[model samples]
Target: MREDFLHYVWQQQYFDKQNLLTETGELLTVLHPGFHNTDAGPDFLNARLQLGEVEWNGAVEIHLRASDWHRHQHQTDARYDQVILHVVLTADQPVLRTDGTPIPTLALAGRIPLEMLHTYQQLQTAPPATLPCAPFLTKIPEITRLSMVDRALLERMERKSATVQLLHQQLDNDWEATAWHVLAAGFGFRKNTEPLARLAKALPLRILRRHRHNLLQTEALLFGQAGFLSAANEKAEDIADEYVQMLRAEYEFLRHKYDLENTGLKEHEWNFLRMRPANFPTARLAQLAALLHARPLLFDALLSAQNVAVLEQFFSNESSVYWRTHYRPGRAGKVPALGRSSMHLLITNVVVPLRVAYARSVGQTEQVEAALQLLTELPAEKNHVLALYEGLPFTHRTAADSQGLLMLATAYCQPLRCVECAIGSRILRHNSALK
Candidate 1:
């Protein structure tokens, strides 16, 4: 069994604790199992324990084997000196603190219920191809599954918020710039997120705002900064297009005007191979330019969206007059403006995260709630990841539910971190059957 299972057993007091004794034959009475510590130092902190006639309050460290104490080199770390006890599944060897004091040891090999261990072992042996906890999914209470998914969703939003907050701090607490960078990265969808983020950072929002009133100039700045308007990037056929030539000339003048000649990206930094024409970086850049030109207060517009319809309308911009017929730089292809699914994705990724980040920055609780409320109004996302949980009762009704399941699948299940999952924890505790 894994070390974490031992931790769970100890935390929940699932193991037999009557007549407990340390390896040194001291009567060990656990007054308090202590708080489970996730950070560095000990596994459990502030433990209140009774060793014989002595009452000790300190940390408790756990390991699969007693030898793990030295294997982890806790003997040298002074932080572990506070360890009042070393609780292990097997007490094969003794341990000492940095001061050479022998820490009391409690072996739990036979103390824990055999049934629980067997069940957890069964889950660990499940086939990896399917969902990590697929077999025991139905056995878990529906409410429990829902609650865990909600937690996963919150975790995802918070994680995204952290990213946005970091960007906000890096941009010197500028919400608009943070929104711009996040939106630019989100517009990349997945394939070109890094380059898109880099492109956004290189071309500041102020520069884009300066030229937003003129659509051509706005597109020129974005396309130019993204490395698309450079001569080395231009295809032989695209060189003769009037719009392309005009854009190139406009970007050169704008670049020189702004003294940004050296801050442009290479054309090869973008990804276009095997992707649909509509979702191409060039097309996405065009849509971003349109959105920037349409709304000067873009972050405000996103926040003030009353419902999904209004939020969706924000992304309904049809780019430019020329883009109505062309999808890429010089490509002769007709692609629709952000499709319904694509718009929904933008709301889910860009709008939701951006709103949450903004709300948290100003410490507005209602605003944060309102930001999350938008997801409940939007349609559920349909993709392979959600499909993995097809038969489960995750509902997948709205973007919120889908978002929860997506977070669970992408973060917890795929990584085989079942021991840390609520559903998996339940299955281990109850020995739920597999499909």
Candidate 2:
């Protein structure tokens, strides 16, 4: 069928290798199968084979049909000149190399093992309405399942940390606030993550580094950058005044820096229906910016600092005093308070990923456990990743696994590549015989 299936068969040597023959009735002896090249040019590179009494060394290419060589236009390319063999499922035409020399052809349809063929056919077939191997996976040893999950978790962490390293590279190694931005984006959860991360990415860390003392200005810049300067329509004069001058300066500076058309707020489209001010992008960014400005080197302290008491002491009263009573610029709200949600967000997204990233940079596994413990000190998170796994019976629910799940979802699950997932792959293989 597909060339990938043929590749799987050939690469695995599922076909009979003991005795082989060419379509021209010449006895073929295999010396090498060649390297499977995923890059440009031939399918397989540098093969060695014996054609009857003659021995040759070159490349091997495969096709579903012999006529595919010309169909794919490889005959005009000099790259196919070195192809010593052309293995196909069907030989419909005589294939010639770029030099007009006849290329050796081998049809593998009758040469492959019947048992392997049957197994492959059965595994790839349409299921009988149910999943392929549900009963069998349940019978697998619990230890194996646990080991597999653990491996998956570690693999996920390693992969996520690579992203951190790339971000650190982009930031020129101000790993501290990069961690904060990452965690802050996670705070909005999936619905608003991209927008939040965009705010973080758009607002440079240099701005935070410079005005790390003025929390209001910090928030103003962050919030204003996200197109949230709506002080004109606000009912509270004090709230409007708080950001008026800062918003003016921000607009002027932003116009020069970003070269934008308009920075003025359009009052009609702004939505403040049921969302509390603390959750509003304006108030939250301001509060978060204030917090970051208050503690510029917070990430460094978080990494080395072991105790939860220490972190709490550093972050407990870190939000803007205004945020305690107001969620937006001027809605007259008193119920809002800087919740542990942000703290937990910082820990889960920034601190944990940073530690994991640092661990990878230094090749230390201990930081993973340390990062996990830090997240556990905070409350449990509610995200798409956690929600998906919430219904599944998990024996281990450590912060490490939670962080791993976050990485897994953001990195893998959300994109729907479950087939490549350990659990999904395991489930697939378990049902392979019944497919």
Candidate 3:
């Protein structure tokens, strides 16, 4: 019933071909259906067809109703003038070109198979459900489902790596800088990623490189650039804290040295309300400072560490004495170092993408596969979106599978794009409901 369904039927030749006729009863012969166009003009282009005793080559346009030609005002447009045939589900009215030449109409109302419509209607008109195909998932074969999920996981990683590629380009093709920015964003977790990335961009890797050997100076640059060195960020009682005062003094000196007076983030750019204290941006920044201070080259470390265990050990010690004792500067509390799950997330989000981007840049195709392989070794991410499939037939359980399910939830299920999904297509095909 939908225009896209009609477009699908037309493109796939789903309707009968025995003794074709345009509504006026001129014998029709479709030598070629033409290429489907997605742009602003005709539905199909460069079509070769035979109408009555004459042969013609032009475009073919499809509409659910012939009256839609007028509804769309294609009669006045020169773009539609090239249309030699108007294929519609029903011929409600006559149509003409810009110069008043009659374009032939082909009505496919009775020609299309009924069962196909029944299957398509189910996919297109499913009720408000998170996964509309959930009811039919049991009908989809295991191999088909697993293959699609694997494809989705690769697609999700590719999408995530695209952001890495853009960062690499913006950082003048420096993989080290790109890795730093990616790790900074990953450290932000979910809420403060943009601000953290902005902070990293403001304080470039070159500047961080000079101070990496000295943890205090590195902390000074990160905290100062994050706008935490300002008095507004300090509590009244904490003003006399010797450690906080020392960092502030050192940041002021560094700020003046690097001429970075106006290039720092505001506190409002970070999100602190409602989230746990451990997940605070302040705690995350301290963790990031520790990583940069210990690891001189982040991208090189990623290249050298192929396995997940190596990467796990590398991210384990991301805390200094000050960070272990305080959640934020001038605040007296115990702060936990990055946990196993947090480290897994950083490796999945930052390390994997960094590997893939670097591999593609250097034309090392196998390294990309090795990078994606890391996901399979890590534990699956546990979240509400994935929790929905707990009792279902989806048996694949790894970070790859979790990522795939998340991708499938957003990119296919949420959009109700089942007709194009592999599982949905197989269900329809196996039931003799589709071509």
Candidate of highest lDDT: 1
| Superior by lDDT: candidate 2 or candidate 3 | 3
Give the residue spans of candidate 1 off by over 4 A.
432-435
lDDT against true structure, model 2: 0.65
lDDT of each: 0.86, 0.65, 0.85
Which segments of model 2 are wrong by more than 4 Å? Answer: 29-36, 46-50, 53-58, 110-136, 139-155, 172-184, 230-279, 302-318, 334-349, 355-396, 399-435
lDDT of 1 by residue, 341-416 (tens): 8888888888888888888878886787787888898888888788888886567889999998889988888776
The C-alpha RMSD in Å for every predicted model, in order, reads 2.3, 5.6, 2.8
User: On residues 1-435, what C-alpha lDDT tens digit does candidate 2 reach at each position?
Assistant: 457667655654556665688888788987878889989898988888999999999999899999999999989999999999999989898899888999999998876656555534543452543222233346555665565556666676566677888887887777676676675676554556666776677666666577667666666666666665644544555455554556556655754665543432343434445775556655555556656776777667767878666765555544566655555554446545456666556566666677889877777887787766775566545654566556444443555566655655555455434344454444444433322
- Sorted on lDDT, highest at the top, how do the candidates line up? 1, 3, 2
TM-score of 2: 0.69
Clashes of each: 2, 2, 0
Task: Give TM per candidate.
Answer: 0.96, 0.69, 0.89
Q: Distance from true position, residue 338, model 2, in Å?
A: 6.3
**Pairs clashing in candidate 1?**
135-434, 135-435
